[model samples]
Target chain A: MKCPLCGLEFNQEDGLKGCSGCKSMGACGLIKCPNCGYEVPAESGIVKFIKRWRKKTDESK
Target chain B: MTVNLSRKRPQCHSTADMEIDARRSVVLVGSPNVGKSVVFGNLTGMYVTVSNYPGTTVEITRGRLADDSRAVAITDTPGMYSLLSITEEERVARRVLMENRPDMVVHVADTKNIERMLHLTVQLLEAGMPLVLDLNLMDEAERLGMRVDTKVLKERLGIPVVATVATKGMGMDELKKMILKEDILPSGPPLRYPETIENAIADIAKNLDSSYGISKRAVALLLLQDDHEIWQMVRDREPERYALVDAIVKHARERFADPLNYIITIERQRFINTLIEDAMDNDQVKGIPFRERLSRLSMHPVAGVPIFLGIIYLLYEFVGVFGAQTAVDFLEETVFGQYINPVANRIVSSIIPWKVLQDLFVNEYGIITLGIRYAIAIILPIVTTFFIAFSIIEDTGYLPRLAMLIDRVFKKIGLNGRAVIPVVLGFGCDTMATMVTRTLETRRERVIATLLLALAIPCSAQMGVILALLSGSTKALGIFVMVMGTVFLFVGFLAARLMPGERPLFYMEVPPLRWPKLSNVLTKTYTRVEWYFKEVLPLFILASILIWAGRITGLFDLVIKVLSYPTGWIGLPPEASKAFLYGFFRRDFGAAGLYDLKTSGALSGVPLVVSIITIALFMPCIAQFSMTIKERGWKMAVGMAAFIFPFAFVVGYLVNLILNGLGVVL
Candidate 1:
């Protein structure tokens, strides 16, 4: 899947991911452009989930 | 691609005990207003308004950036986008990066929209600034069904990329580790351009012999686009090198179909795309996930309406009924009313001989007898339960789901999904929600939200008491709903009509539902209750002091006398006048007074209903008045009070008339 906006291609899991804020496609990119808080969509869930779970696991340890 | 950007040389100079060494200080440097303040506050211990919309954070807020680092100072800068500064704010951030250069910089970007944001990230990498990319608002990204393979992207960029939900404090640890490690080194096959572009870049890099902070190759690319900041920096320090860079940019600009910036952005996208393709594999089903399907059903006009009502009912049942009726009665009457106040009165009478002094401590309106008791006994328990419930809702991230569920309906009345927070919060505290109106995207939305909050949404105390009161009466509850619902919709529509503006679009990143964490919920509850106690306890005690003074001065009698006509008109007893006055001090106090009247059998059905209705529509507490003044200014606060005073009585009169006229004898 290609992020139509950014054109970052990934697989199915990457296409259907959510952010930590609200779990929708509204605010998942990184931060609102430090310049503008405009909402930007990211890739899907696989990479995002792995990264987050890894982060959480790291914290727990 | 984790890069070690930290190099230490600065002498220990900061005198503040809070000073964090560069090794410990993982500065979250990004463009302002990118939730950096929130990340800082959450990681460290601070309280910054999540949304004040004041973009220029002139002074940096320092927090002991918590996590794996024993104690680090996290710095939040005004919103800035790139290393190449165009705006003064950007220059400030760049200066921070150059001067205090912390162990690492966490680049927080709105995850939903990364294409535009990543440009700055790329620039930072090019500048070789120590960095970890935080794909913040992962909740928002997931809601929109966009996926980001940060690990893959991390591998490709060769920098530590951590995704975060800074608002809810998710992924902070991973972000911290990534920052502490400063592990990703920004190295890759520098993004290759088309052969023609490659030759052009080669020509430029060959001529430009400048050992800048970043690679000269990256400098050449920035120069090609005529990045003014970079160009200015080069011109000042290396005019000879800049002259060559200028020629390459002019030539490249001539070759590009679009503007040079656009052309560069396209190339950057190409690079990001290529990297994603190699490292990422998203395995999502087509059409919709079961969650999305459930969400669709939940938002359906038919199904959603019922669900919304059901949720509202549950909220009232737990918060209003259980909290207001059971917990409040037990605490206010059985505990405080029966035992504490009497014991305190006897003790104060025995200890203090001066009547005036005794009045201050244990009289009818004494601080101990009334103020502290009310704050601790009546408000605390209710607020604790409420904050716990609220934190859970917020943590589970159901609010956005509820927003989407009701967005369509809200749109019809000139509101959007964002209005959900204010309206829902109004149930907990209208004053707080009024302050939150700043979050609405538009001035019109703020006005409408504020109006709805004041006119309809009862603050927690009033709402809970009212809910408790009416929960027993099917007809009364139905009537209450009809009246409040009608007024909310009607006023919102009217405000939207009067306010001149384009209807701002509704967009919310509705995160997937999750079970709320208990500790997080408890912490949030504790914070809220502590704040509530601070605000309420003082005001309640001050109110008691005022009441005592009023009694001694005969001011209380005069006010009660003045209130008598309205009381008579509304068909209530003379003592009810005191309740109305207390209502102004705090709605819950008036509610407690009403309970005092009800339990004593002073007023029954019609008068009770009328009195309840009127007080519910009446002015909020002294604290609320002060808050209203602080937030909306004197004009709105005074005007709101002016309308509410007689308006409550007049409405009470009308309701009495209607019920009396209809022979509504319950």
Candidate 2:
């Protein structure tokens, strides 16, 4: 996902990997951009479901 | 050929193997999201091993090229913009390049952003790497009516160039051919700095007795730019020669008005402009797209104020009128008041025989009647709507533009535009935002930002409750906003004047505004609301218990009596002192206390607005105070709190005096 602040695109896992040292311990539910420390909310299950469904439909098309 | 793909870190590569394969390896390097991964996939085929780099959590991917004949190993380094790194990813990427001394270094760049990408290219060349400039995303560049003369680019940079739409497999064969070519040599540095800098670089390089894998010239440049890693490396490697190099850097720095890094970047950018002019053409007219025009308008000084006000108005309508009033009334009145509270009271009364226990769970200030009701019925809908609105605004990419627009205003507060990130996030959660103040460039900026956040910025929960409390009177709401805004600016101005520090420079990228994706907005809102519930629900229950305990012990009344003196001085009723007490626990809890009083007809009109302003400007909650202590240390945190609490009441006292003195009736 693209970082909202600096526009750097990084994988969510990569972003989270760098956040291990954050004081919140990920309970804040924010995924910080690895490039800049800008925090963004992680995608929810509903969003993931919708995304997967959309991808499947696109592949079928 | 089966590629060895291991996800585990320890098993990925032995140190000896890494050293042995260094010469035959290829490392793909580029800024984030420039298609380096895609290019790596094309070269290495389906299977690749990913492991954490040694001593760091940053993942590094490695695989053997698909061509079994050469059996050349390829590693895809993390995205990095420059050798003088800031983020750990960039540092790891540079370490990979310098340590591996790869036979081929492919600098994958987005063709559409070649100008920005070339900054890294110039650095790589300066580092004397054997680089092949792969202009990825060719289709996107062409769609933008951009064309790059690859032959001219290759000729000018003295490196091989390949153009490819990596996702579509275009130019793959050529890229493969280039990677496979033997005898690729490091290109000479493409940029020559001013004479003073060049002479310094030469001087530093001549004194270097150690081989640092890369050219001594690159080390000199990194040292001149004050790259900490290079400084440490040079200090460790050339302990005797380090001082001589350091003196040379200091002498060169003395000759420049600006920082050496800035000076060097300007020179490199100038060289890149000429190179781009010679090798690139754009058939598309210079007409701004609608998005671009909108972005510009949003950052325009005069135009942006209305846009900012417009956003605030929309937020007021959505969160205040709709969520705070409509939804809150339904939940607080119909759901909790009519149904949940009655049932809870009955259940607790029937089960717990003692009146004290019963009151603890059901009566006035009861856990169920006040704590759960406030958390779910009052604060929930308001924060939900706020998070929704905030998510939409964030997804639209307007915050950075807002940052740019406010940069000038922020400078007066001794903060640059970057402080906007923490300041805006403070509205959501000041505790979390306090943690983010570390992003500010200077200690002074962080302290000021932290103070402003603690003082004037109301978190969403508190703002929502206050909005609901004042929703009845527009004049009251307007007064509340005006007072808070004035205090924010006045205090920040004073702090800036009092604090001694270098003036901060503001620079930020303003991404084009786009329609917010519903999925993204919903996801963000859901995550935030869920977090709020997890964090806040228990706090509410605990606050209720603590209040119950304090009342039983008579400690609560003593505190309330003492608090009521200042509460009365602010022209608030004695009952409002309870809210002020709660304000120390959580600002939103204090606001909710005011909400209860307002509903009961115990507080209204000017006193309501006065109490709200004072509470809004009160010291941050216990959590935020602890964070302040953590971030700023004990002395600073205590100092800020010591000044803030009295300052808040004093401001309240003054606003009350001026308003009543003017006989302005709400």
Query: lDDT of model 1 at residue B403?
Result: 57
B258-312: candidate 1 lDDT, tens digit per residue:
4455456667777765665554335532334566666666767678777666765
User: What lDDT tens digits, residue by residue, belong to model 2 across residues B527-551?
Assistant: 8888778778999999999999999
Error of 2 at B140 (Å): 3.2
TM-score per candidate, chains pooled: 0.57, 0.81
Sort candidate 2 into its docking category: acceptable
| First chain of candidate 2, TM-score | 0.78
Candidate 2: the clashing residue pairs are none
TM-score of chain B of 2: 0.82
**DockQ, every prediction:** 0.03, 0.41
Query: After superposing candidate 2, which stretches have Cα over 4 Å from the reference?
Result: A9-31, A40-61, B1-26, B40-76, B84-92, B113-116, B141-164, B168-208, B220-285, B412-421, B439-441, B467-482, B601-606, B654-666
Predicted model with the maximum DockQ:
2
